[model samples]
Target: MSAEIKQAKCIAVLGTGSDVGKSVIATALCRIFSDRGYKVAPYKAQNMSNNSGVTPEGLEMGRAQIVQAEAARIAPHVDMNPVLLKPVTQIGSQVVLLGKVHKDLSAAQYHREKEKLWDTACGALDRLRAPNDVVVLEGAGSCAEVNLMARDIVNLKMAAYAKAPVILTADIDRGGVFAQIVGTLACLNKAEQDLIAGFVINRFRGDIALFKEGVEWIKKKTGKPVFGVLPWINHHIPNEDSVVIERPEAKTDPVKTPTVLVVRTPHISNFTDFDALFQVGGLAVDFVEHPIDLSAYKAIILPGSKSTRSDLFWLVKTGWASKIQAYVKNGGHVLGICGGYQMLGTKVRDPEGLEGPPGDTDGLGLLLLETVLKAPKTTTISRFEWDGIPGLGYEIHMGRTAGADRIALGKKSNDGLLRVKERNQQACTEFDGAVANSGRVMGTYMHGFFDSVPILKKWLSLLGLNELEPPEFCGPQGRDRQYDTLARHFEKYVDVAAIVKVTNID
Candidate 1:
């Protein structure tokens, strides 16, 4: 699309393992490049798994790319996430376009269709390269799976096609960070290996002084510079992968502090919906395994689930159904988003297994309506004004609910959906422990609703809590100050300047 294809510079970030902080590193790199005044874009050729977001153009992309784009302070682009596969079953998944699910196909079935997806990926990357000084590409999972490597469009093939240099990141905490990097290089074909510029060691939890010998061992083994040994940052960062976000055993605080239980279920996508809750002061958030008591919490929330029927089944099996109902019956507040919102209703129907074949599943009976899964999924940003709440939030969930005459969280536009209306609504509305119905309970499909001050305050008031202060916006000054804070945390162990130097404009 541009004459500068030959001149445009790019870099690919690949991980030695999943959940090794590759997305975190890429976002940090975006901030670094953006701070230097270079036009930068973040890209990921193909992203499998669930956890998607709708772009400004009304197209769908992975949520991780959106975070990286925010780091660059750019409007999210669809081409940034060329292919998204949201699994509907163990072997089958729904193929998505820029933001909507186009069709459902098995893994083997989808491979046959990848050529068309690859063409779209290339087109998106080409557009990203057209107007930027640098495009940082993030790879999915390990690049060493030889079997899947042939079909891989997100990692090596994407790097080759983009003509971008690659930097492999291996997790030192996994043990054998050296072997992971070396084994990866050994596995790749020579051309793929040649694309690598160097590697970074991520999530090192020990004394950096102790790793000097191992660092030397890696250098002598691969002859490539170990760019940085980054220590783990305990600071709050967005969890890009839903799987990691869903399980918080390690990150969860063990103290018997005031706890809010998140009911875990099958098809749980977008667990990041509760990220703010995780950091709420004077409160602890934990995922309750089955057979656990729900009566112990001051509040309970059911997050978005991919399969309403299956997750509802899980709720029954885990005995959380009766427990949740009992909690509400005893005057506790319950909140649900997306599929979780559906489960809070009267009933759910799937005639086709868009989640599964033909059945009507009973809801938790928390809300008054019913939800029916449709052939085409509903994915969009809902802007609404509810009972006086304001601010701008987005909705990217499927299925529809009925029977509730009014929205408790947000109002509807002509387009029809709930979104943030006021900035302080999240804080003011939920402060000092205020509950909507008081006797029953309340919830909405809006994810970032609590980010609003009023809404947050009102919700907290219902539970007898108070907000210390409003959350800082995720803008340039805010992110800069936050990232600087993060950098300081890593200053003692990580090679901060070296990371910036690796991504610096030439």
Candidate 2:
């Protein structure tokens, strides 16, 4: 609401801490404003995650922004998320600036370059705001980290730059709701505290009336409005980070449905690929960290990973490798995707040290293929088919795979697919992925492979779960519906009119 802020109005959602629902709140705001006839776009200065998606221009960014773009009914762009940090090791991360890999930098080295990166982030935000009616900026992690405040470009600094009003969000489910908000405000200086328009409490379970006194106490203590208390939603939305996997859900009876176990690796990436699988009736998807009895499940899935070699090493060291092999020998089916695909091959060579130290490692040897981790990464919106079943997916990988007697999953093309669109208007006709001669094992570079209805149906049938029916909506259509539902759920709890007023949007 400052004269310096021109063209688009901006409102930022900053969390008290990580996984406190900043992305979800920002996403709802995008859809709400879009529904109100405003052209909305989402911006996150820096995102640290390996769960990414490719844009129509064949650029890569965090998948959370892609979901936000869809909620706004617009095409996604790299400008929406300028800096992405993909942790490849305990000490270092692959820094992606403006949708491309800039370099691998350690924590200390990355901090030294913050000044330059901050400028880049600001430029991206300016570009995003230029053509939009409103830009919903999302802050990463805690907005009140005292030590990181000076170096922070995503929270208060970015908000101050945009002259955007901030709505501090906290998860009541995490407990200490009072302390969470009060302590956060206490950490900020007076000017920063004044920037906060109000507070939104998320993930409140149980009776709302029971918390009325608590809400009143917070309002009086902070001298700020409590916008609303959001109830925990049971629906599935793609998580911006993998931390959600640590918070376990209520156990479901495995006997009622055929289960698919996903080997939860240390560095899991793009695990959202299984979101579609979770929706299929009579099928349950579980992420398992320890080696479990695979006999109870219909099939096993090795999801994508940031450090393929390291995770593959984990599979062997943790006893999952032997268990998976035994399951395959018992005539069980298995599917490996991206880094997982690399692990299923005969050998994986990282001679150039793309993932780690220069060397070679033996794969699970399920497929007669070899993978070489080499230079420039491949990121594309792809179209393909599997056993004549049309499919749509995207490929994001850094290695070239080769094999003979490989059953082609699909030949990539510019057309003839259901969901994915042609990138850069170019036609491509390359074959991707492979299937074992035994037909029990398959591997693909494509993420979102199961998003295709026909492919999901066929795969289920192949796994002997023929009785289960595919959901009414699948892929993009289904995902869009979920976003709309999320928006509605959020609106029911939050004060939308007050939020609009706070943004000073006409």
Candidate 3:
């Protein structure tokens, strides 16, 4: 909306393959530009992932955009991510258009509506570009997937649309970095190939001097410059994708390491809620799909699910429900967040069939609440308190939930978990989440609760794990520090001058 930033240029960070660090690269550039005193924003026309976040306006968007906006030191908006596809089934996804739920569309039906979606994407891009000096664009998956190329509006096609210069990123640690870079160029026609300005080699392991030949070979093969070879980063960034949960896991021991278990549901969303645990030392987190012996872990956490009912059935079918119950019966701690919070109650009713079939599904019965799926999803950046300690988090869910006794009145009781002071940037007094009389079983709809030091410390104290202490650099300030570190890392290897040259901004 500022006249000063109307002259924004696009710089696309496309990938040679999925998980090639496109999002991370874009995030770094956004910070680098912002530190230089330019107003920068991030844009991704469409994103397909279960991971997402709510904007300050209480609208839904991809979590990656939210992270980038934080790096740029601005409030997140829907235009930064116009279309978000949260896959609910193998063939279908819940389409969120311009920050509101559009509809559930199958793959075939979504493609049929591509023409309209393309218009919406372009409009969002124009609106985003109107208010910044530079808008860093991030591409999804491979930019040169020939089969999906014709229908793909995310990668090369989008770059061509904005006349944005592309910097293709490849994961050298995955092997075949040369093939990934050269083969991508080979697949592109002249016009499409010309859009790409250069390359950024990501996750390069071992000595950089050893890979000089590899860089030169890529440059000679494609007649393009190798912008940088980023060494393997020991530093942590947010989740690249949910596929990371599938990595091999080690055994948990409440006695040895104070480990915790996160039930890995098939439709898990917003697993980034626990990303902080990895940063602060002394604690370990693991995602487990199958029912495991729960006695070894200090606590069990149920994360958010895109389909609450579907994942509820999975909990029962997979015997995880019983396993969790047994863990709670033994006085071990258990916490559920978001959809996982919905699953902790007695029953989940969906008479409108908002999430698939219309029916009632039994919950894990750990809490005294019940949930009914309803219209106009609750998406808010919330400010709340626990035991007089202030905390910040977001609420993104559907329907209403309350104590079974209070269900008739349709009101959440004062006995609920946190005291909410504000939602969606508006002030109001209300109670959120539920807790059992035993206090061992706790459930809340709030995501990122652990980001608050008081809430995290309180949870640890409640679990009687006095030995575990959260690190000081684990909050927003810590995150900002990490962004600076990331910018410094990229600046060391990547050619920022060359990037600015390509953007025509210098």
Q: Which is the leading candidate under TM-score?
A: 3
Q: What digit string (tens of lDDT, one per residue) describes model 2 on residues 1-506?
A: 76665568999999999999999999899989999999999999999988999988888899999989988999999999999999888888999998898999999999999999999999999988889999999999999999999999899999999999999999999899899999999999999999999999999999988999998999999999989999999766787965535642324455666888888888889989998888888788888787777876788899999989999999999998999999999998999999998899888888899887999888999987878887798888887767666777888999787762321332232221233334344665556777888888988888989888888999999988889978887778887888899999988988999999999888
Score each candidate by Cα lDDT: 0.71, 0.87, 0.88
RMSD after CA superposition, every candidate:
4.9, 3.6, 2.1
Tens digits of per-residue lDDT, candidate 3, 1-506, equal 75654558999999999988999999999999999998899999899988888898889999999889999999999999999999999999999999999999999999999998999999999988887888999999999899999999888888888889999999988899988988999999999999989999999878899988888888888899999999977655575485547552445565678788898898999988987776656888888887767898888899999999999999999899998988899888989999999999999999899888799999999987889999888899999999889888998898888877777687667668899999987998998887888988888899988888767888888877667768676657767888999999999999999999999865
Which runs in model 3 stand beyond 4 Å of their true positions?
1-6, 248-255
Clashes of each: 45, 0, 0
The window of 10 residues in a row where model 3 has the poorest summed lDDT is 242-251
Q: Who is ahead in TM-score, 2 or 3?
A: 3
By lDDT, who's the top model here?
Answer: 3
TM-score of each: 0.87, 0.94, 0.97
Better of 1 and 3 by TM-score: 3
Q: After superposition, how far is residue 77 of candidate 1 from its true place, in Å?
A: 1.2
Residue 327 C-alpha lDDT in model 3: 88
Which clashing pairs does model 2 show? Answer: none
